[model samples]
Target: MMQLFRHLRLGMKIGGGFTLILLLTAGVAVIGVRGLTSIGTTVTLTTETNRMAHEALSARAQEKDALLRGEAQTITQTQQHITAIGQQATTTKEKIADPTINEQLGAVVAAAGDYAKVFQQATEVRQQQTAAEEKMAQAAETLVKMAQAIRESQYQLLAEIQEKTQVAIQANRANVDDVSQIIQGIMQLRLTEEQFRLQRDAQTQAQVDSRHAAVVQLARNLQARLQTARNSVGTQVNDGMEDDAGLDIHTLAEQIIDLLETHHAGFTLYATELTEQLQAETEMAKQARLLEEQAERIRADQQQEFAALQQLQHTRPEVRNATLANVQATEQFIRGVLTVRLQEQRFVQGADAQA
Candidate 1:
């Protein structure tokens, strides 16, 4: 091959040399173009990755702010931002060469979606809590009204009892002492009932029951005396004995007996009313306690959710601290509300104030 090349014309050799040079130059150009294209692609990928990272970081900041502030508008803004970040991540994952990076992007998208759902749930829970608190306040107000009505009724019944006792005393002059004793027994019963309502202890309740029995016995004795007087008066009338004012002693005795029976009936009605009022108060207290327990359970659930959120890998230290503080504050506020409700319930039920 060297002998054949040496025998070639000089012009042909020069043309061959030029052709070889041109081929070498074309090859170098192709390699340089390929290198430039690769560098441009790498730069674009890096820029997109950086932008996505920055967007993700911004979304995280917004999420933390939204959670700390607990505002609907802020949460909505955070959700929008997260959605945008997720879309960007989805697009970036398609471009990413590494499978691990794509997986990380997918994780970020899922985490952002979870955060949004969690925020929505938290908002709903807060709304439910607010409604429950309002209902509790309304229940407390209703209890107060019921207590006031019961107290007013008691006062009215007591007044009526006093008026009836005075009428009995005036009507039965011959049995005035017995009537007075009945009145005194009724007054003692009233006092015992008041003590029971105030103390609400077993001893006070026993005293009230004893006083009621004494009052009933006194009423029975007065009734027996009135019956004896009525029989005696009837016998006198049959014997033609009448009062100086031309009033029939038999009719007077009958009127007195009727008044005594009416007074006893009134007392029985008052006792029934008092029992019903006490039962109503007990039921109200039970309902209030149940509402308080429900509120406490909801608060506990909220605290547990906050703790779970804090434990997430994406949760920042600052956000965790803020969440903890918010939880403590909410607990303290709820405790104060519960204490007030408990006191109100105790007041309505006539339970021990100290307890």
Candidate 2:
């Protein structure tokens, strides 16, 4: 068997199969890692951008508030000034009632009148500022709406990308398992019927039976995983986060498995063509054992990875179903405004027709 394995070209079909499996797995692992990296990077970038945008908006609001406060202060000062001037004017008018004090009182009243005019002009300027402030607030609100729309779009996009990435990772995991199983099965085919019969008879060996049972269990588990994944995906696509990570993993495992089954069928067909070439060879049982060993190793590795993935999934927080009450309220308000506007427009048309 060892000799047969030695004759097995490192570039032979068996070796090539192993290499392909490794390459596929590596490619998927790299992609998965990159996707995770991207998720983190994107989240950070969006958070920073949102923070900056909100900060800028808040600053503008604060500036507007300050301007309004300053205008208020100015209006208050002007009113006080006008009140003082009026008081001064009243005193002067009282003094002017005496003909002797009339000339001095006239000058005093004239100066008070000028002060009052200045205060009036200041008040007008303050009113204009208040109007300008209102316009700015409206503009800011419009900008906020646009930003919110953009953010919502991005949120939807983010959710979609996350789902796609999860699917990809799941598919990759399944492919790796399939490749491992296929390699094991193909290698096992080299065994002589007598040798297989011997192993079957010796199935009393707990370890051998255990391994056999494991393979069968794995297949069943894969099917169950697929079903769970389908269900989880259905829910995930709806509106909220999915709590069941296993479902997703199972779904991905199924894709690889289905592909493997297809490949295995093709391989079985090809094996028919190679039967003559294989039967001519002796010590094929040794080659079978080597292949089985390789398969076992691959299985071990896969199980480890699967376990780790499961652990990670288990650690994930359950999806929260928090309600955005504010958004709901705003939607209601918008509907009300639209209804009122429609009614007002109809009333205006009716009045115009009557006129």
Candidate 3:
């Protein structure tokens, strides 16, 4: 081969050398171009990764904002942002050549999906809590109105009882002793009724029942005495007393009986109303307890979700912070519900108007 090259013509040898050099230069240029192309691709991938990271952080910020604002529109916006990030991550992962990077992107997509799902669940629970709170507030308002009505009824009944007692005493002046006894019994009944109104317990109810029975008996005795007096007046009339005096006594006795009967009927109705009010209060207490329990359940669920999020591996700091903010917001909401329940209890069981 060396002898052949040595014996070749000068021009041919130079042309061959030049051709070789050109081929070598072309190979080198191709290699350099490939390297530059690879570097550009790497730079592009890096820029995309940085953009995805920025998007993730922005989505996390939106999540926190949604939690702080507690608005449905904000929450929906946050969810959409997270979904977009997840989609971008998926697209980027397909382009990634490194298996490890691809896996990391997959983890990010999973985390975003989890966050969106959990956030949606939390939003649903928050809505339920709001509905429950509204219901509790409505019940409380109704209970307050019922209490006002009961108080008004008590006052009206008491006034009626006092008026009837005074009328009975004035009408039966001759039977003052009987009237006094009847008045005493009525006063005792009123005292027991007031006690029942204040306490609304079985013991106080029993006292009221006993007092009612005693007043009924006293009223019957007074009626019998009035009947006797009426008969005596009739006998006196038959024996020559003034007819006008006898008629007046009879009319007064009838008036006293009518008043007693009317007052007794009113008291019976008042007792029935008291029983109904008591039942209403009991139902209100039960509803309040149920609302409190629901609030507790919501709080527990939020805590459990927070714990689950904490346990997740490779979670971004932004996602973790957003989770914590959501938990805190849920806790605040639960505390408000508990406060409302406390107020309901006070309204249901407390005797004072301040309650």
Candidate 4:
């Protein structure tokens, strides 16, 4: 029991010694690790705080520079504005004091106003002048048309008169040829004096009877035609009076009557001679054709030649002259009026331009 107790005490001493050694080593290792961790954390926190401080300083410096530049720019802009205001004031003073410049400006303003008014008046006057010119031109054109119409009407009237005159002349020519042929036939028959007397008496009586009937009929026909011509002439004169704005229709009518009178006697004589000649020609042709048909053909040929001679009389100068004179007179009157109107228009235009 004594040995066991001692052994236990020694074992306890040994175990306590080992436990103390282990506790000492473990406490030293824990303190060393904690010291290292605290040192590393302190160094890292210091570096981060230093970097943040440097950034704050740089930001403050940049803010100061921006504020300085903004102040300088504001000062320069204000100075420039003040200088510009001074220049404007100086220029205003100079303009207000210069008499010649002020006068010139006033003159320019007045001139502009006057020019506007003058331009308006000029435009109005030009329009009026143009309208007047157009009206004058239209009037002149109307005159020209009237003149042309008058000329044509006069020409037609003269041509108709000339045709009538030519017809009278042709009839006279036919009568003369027929009378000559009748005389020639009588002479060529070679009848004895007694036979000639007896044949002449019979022929004269027959011719007298035929001539009386033909003359009565011709007189009746001529009277009717004369009445118709008179009615037509009266109607034409009235129409001419209405149509001719400036012509003397009474004088024209008198001239027409004179022309008719000039051909009247010749026309009557021609008809009488033509009738006698035709009667003699028929007798001669019958007498000659009783023996031969060839003689009848020859007589017919002579009649045709006489008819052709009458047609040629229509080409006389008197007929053409009458037509030309009437047309020229009417044309001259129209042209003269138109020319005068044109001249008046030109004069008015010139006056307008001067005004």
Best by TM-score: 3
**Candidate 2 lDDT, tens digit per residue, 202-319?**
3323343343344445545645654655566685452222222222333333443443344334333333322322332222223323434543453455445444544454354220
Off by over 4 Å in 3: 1-174, 216-247, 310-318, 345-355
> How many clashes in each candidate?
0, 2, 0, 0
Ranking by lDDT: 3, 1, 2, 4
Alpha-carbon lDDT, every model: 0.46, 0.36, 0.48, 0.33
Q: Candidate 4: which stretches are off by over 4 Å?
A: 1-100, 163-355
- Report the CA-based lDDT of candidate 3 relative to the real structure: 0.48
Error of 1 at 311 (Å): 6.1
Q: Model 4, 108-163: lDDT tens per residue?
A: 23322332232233233334434443443343344234333434544444444454
Q: What's the TM-score of every candidate structure?
A: 0.33, 0.22, 0.41, 0.22
Question: In terms of TM-score, which candidate is stronger, 1 or 3?
Answer: 3
Off by over 4 Å in 2: 1-101, 158-355
lDDT of 1 by residue, 1-355 (tens): 3355344433232222222222222222222222323444434443443344344334434543453355778877766765665576677667655555555556645544543454454445445534443443343344234323323433333344454555433434434444455456556655665565455466766676676566556546655664665566575332212333354433433443344344444434444444443443444345445545654664576577576766753756544444454455446534643654555544544535432
Better lDDT candidate (1, 3): 3
Comparison by TM-score, 2 against 3, better one: 3
lDDT head-to-head 3 vs 4, winner? 3
Pairs of residues clashing in candidate 1: none
As for lDDT, the candidate ahead, 2 or 3, is: 3
